[model samples]
Target: MATIVETAVSAGSFTTLVAAVGAAGLVDTLNGEGPFTVFAPTDEAFAALPEGTVEGLLADIPTLTSILTFHVVPGAVHAADLTDGLKAATVNGAELTFDLTDGVKVNGATVVTADIVCDNGVIHVIDAVLLP
Candidate 1:
């Protein structure tokens, strides 16, 4: 199977996310061997942000990287493994709470697509972008 980067690129809906990752210089890292759990936001999610938000973030590497890292957890966590009221710490050092009781909520974003396998990790597509 493809690596995280390749899978994300092929997914087609993560254009903004992929661009942000490249801008943040995190492409190589995500492509590396890692058991990462990524809460991936679709291009629509990025569009939900205010005007200029994406451009501004792209210009600010540190901020962009932090935002990107907030979507990633240290290990691969599949949907079936998630329990109600589970909280996982992200690569950004922030804790993302999950509410599996009603659908699945990571922080405030719902998991729209779960268990997307990648060579280095798993990707769970979310409707909204998560902030740290």
Candidate 2:
């Protein structure tokens, strides 16, 4: 399998996320050996943000890193292993609650795609970006 960066690139919906990762200087960290579970927000999700939000966040390195890390949970959490009302801790030190009873909801964002395996982790596509 490819690394997290490669997998995100191949998926084709994480372009904004990839760019944000690059801006945050977290490309190497995500590429490193880790069993991270990332609730990756699609490009559309970023687009849904209010005007200037994305650009503003990007200008603030520390906040950008925190927001990016909020999408990642340490360890590989597959769809099957995720419970209906699960709450998982993210790499950013925040807890993301999941509601799988009606499809899959991570934080407030829906998981549109699940179980995208990567060499260092897994990616679950989310429809909205989660804030810190």
Candidate 3:
């Protein structure tokens, strides 16, 4: 099985997210031994942002890091662990509330794909980028 980074890279759909994680200097961190639950946003999700938003974020490492980390919750939380109204604290020190109604939602984004198992963690694809 691949690590979170490898799984995401192999998928090809998370190109922008992978790039942002690299740009944030979090490649090593995410590769580290972890049971992290990453709420990964797809390239389409990133593109959905307003004009130049991604560029602006990429230029700000600290802000980018915060945004990226906000998508990660420590421990390997699978889709089954997420019940309606469950809230988890993110690695960035923010909280994400899950709404099971009409599909799973993390903060303002909906989970498009879930339970992407990685060697060290799990990835749940989201349709929108979650901000802290």
Candidate 4:
């Protein structure tokens, strides 16, 4: 089993996310011990942002880091564990609301794929970039 960072790199769909993580200097934290549930946004999701959004975020480390961390929860929260209206605290010091009523949604981003187990935690692929 690979770490969350390793798994994302191997998946090939999270290129933008991988780069942002590196730029935000969060590669080491996401690779750390214990468990983390990451709502990873795909490259296409990042591309969906405004034309200059990605470039702007890459250059702004603090804001970029906050946005990145907003997608991560402290524990390994699998889809099965999620319930309607569940609120989970993120490493960014904010909370993500789960809406299981219509599929799974985290802060309005649909979960395209769920429960990707990693050596360090789990990765749930989301369709939009979550902002804090």
Candidate lDDT values, in order? 0.93, 0.92, 0.93, 0.95
Cα displacement (Å) at residue 28, model 4: 1.0
Q: Point to the candidate with the largest TM-score.
A: 4
Model 1 spans > 4 angstroms off: none
How far in Å is the alpha carbon of 49 misplaced in model 2? Answer: 0.3
lDDT of 2 at 82: 90
| Model 4: residue 33 alpha-carbon error in angstroms | 0.6
lDDT of 1 at 74: 90
RMSD of 1: 0.7
Task: For each candidate, give its TM-score against the true structure.
Answer: 0.98, 0.96, 0.98, 0.98
Find the 10 residues in a row with the least total lDDT in model 4. Answer: 25-34
Residues 20-101, model 2: lDDT tens digits: 9999998998999998998999999999999899999989999999999999999999999999778889998999998977
Error of 3 at 33 (Å): 0.5
* Every candidate's CA RMSD: 0.7, 0.9, 0.7, 0.6
- In terms of lDDT, the poorest run of 10 residues in model 1 is 99-108
For candidate 3, the lDDT comes to: 0.93
Query: How do the residues 40-130 of candidate 3 rate in per-residue lDDT, one tens digit apiece?
Result: 9999999999999999999999999999999999999998888999989999998999999888898979898899999899999999999
Please give, for residues 1-132, the per-residue lDDT of candidate 1 as tens digits. Answer: 998889999989999999999998899999999989899999999999999999999999999999999999998999999988888899989999999877999998999999999899999999999989
Highest lDDT scorer: 4
List of clashing residue pairs for candidate 2: none
